[model samples]
Target: MALTPPAWRHTLTEVPRGAAGVLRLAGKWRAMATGPRGRGEPVMVLPGLFNSDRSNVALRRHLTRMGYRVEGWGLGRNLGQRAIGQDGERLFARIDAMAERYGAPISLVGISLGGLMARIAAHRMPGHVAQVVTISSPFAGPPDATRVWRAYQALSGARIDDPEVRALVGEAGRPLSVPTTAIWSASDGLVGGAICRGEDCAAVEVRSSHVWVQFNPDVLRAVAVALAT
Candidate 1:
């Protein structure tokens, strides 16, 4: 049986206003100024829920300039729950294909729920996955941080206590067989930073909004470091 989380867990809310957004951009510049160089295998960028591949275009271009093979999730518009089925299967297949084409394992860089999905895919296909880097993902637990996410969970029939989701989350929190890095922020207006914790995961705290994690420079630098490792 899956463990039931405390009711207060669902009350963690998004940061009021968009302060996190401003801080995110600032952190990006800071990362550019001090980040280390990148040298590693290809990287797969997974956008957050309700976001599209276009969302990480800037980050991808930047990483590409830094000498990394950066690719997107190629699926169409991110329509949240709907993207989890056929689209997800196709995405996983693409990861497999990319691994073969590169002749090397691929690193997964997922944002928000996409991070959760990436972890699941990595676990399912460890051979193709080199490293896992998540940005503000709630891997430690369920979607109980905000009313919107709770509603999404209900509407999508994603029971936090469901055996599958629970099992996935539990495994995600355990030591990843491959290197793993989790970038989190106390300023995140969506998921709480607490869920970002893991014993085997290298955790980096950046100042950014939950929505702007893909664009945050510090997070990207941390991702680059993790991939280069």
Candidate 2:
């Protein structure tokens, strides 16, 4: 099936929902621990485009409470290739470091562009990555399928059809040896959810606009379930 950007209605609601998500934060982050507990496994939480590891504080805290050792991407802000490097060597190094430190594979949980990058790590170094969870990431779709395509192009100074860019995108979409889950929502406003998951990957649906998908309570619960089982 073909992929396209989300409709204007969903896009329009993103801001308000983002605000609401912040308020909703007051409710119950503890619910995340109800599902299951971790055994101090290293888990990396990757932020979306233009966002820093700071963006996923709620999720990270919840995961930590669930017994997993969660850490942010450590890289400042997510500027796509600019942040991860031309061939993603920096991201690979981060994964390698975590794996070596833990003496075990680390799970990758990323939102939007971060999710795409997470899949690339799993594809390129499956042994180091135990599993992957992509939130609202359109890795299985074309760049234009998301509202951020032009912004991404501007940030990276590269066109979507560039040969190297295409190769990099190809790496992101390759099948992985580890458990891979794609979490998306039909209510998403920035990117079409249809493109978020490939047929080969497990899919979980939640209700959220693109801006707050990673922070939404239901999304947090979904992430917990994905990581737990």
Candidate whose TM-score is highest: 2
Residue 16, candidate 2: Cα error in Å is: 0.5
lDDT of 2 at 217: 85
**TM per prediction:** 0.80, 0.95
TM accuracy, model 1: 0.80
* Runs of candidate 1 exceeding 4 Å displacement: 1-34, 79-88, 146-148, 154-163
How do the residues 151-178 of candidate 2 rate in per-residue lDDT, one tens digit apiece?
8888768888887677777778777778
Error of 1 at 215 (Å): 1.8
lDDT (tens digit, per residue) of candidate 1 on 1-229: 4423323322343342234554656656544644455674689998876678888886787677677888998876554445545355787788988999899989888888778777877887899998889888888865654324664565556666666656666666666788788998776656777776577688889866665667666666777677666
On a 0 to 100 scale, what is the lDDT of residue 172 in model 1? 64
In angstroms, how far off is 124's CA in candidate 2? 0.9
Q: What residue pairs are clashing in model 1? A: 14-189, 15-189, 28-217
Clashes of each: 3, 0
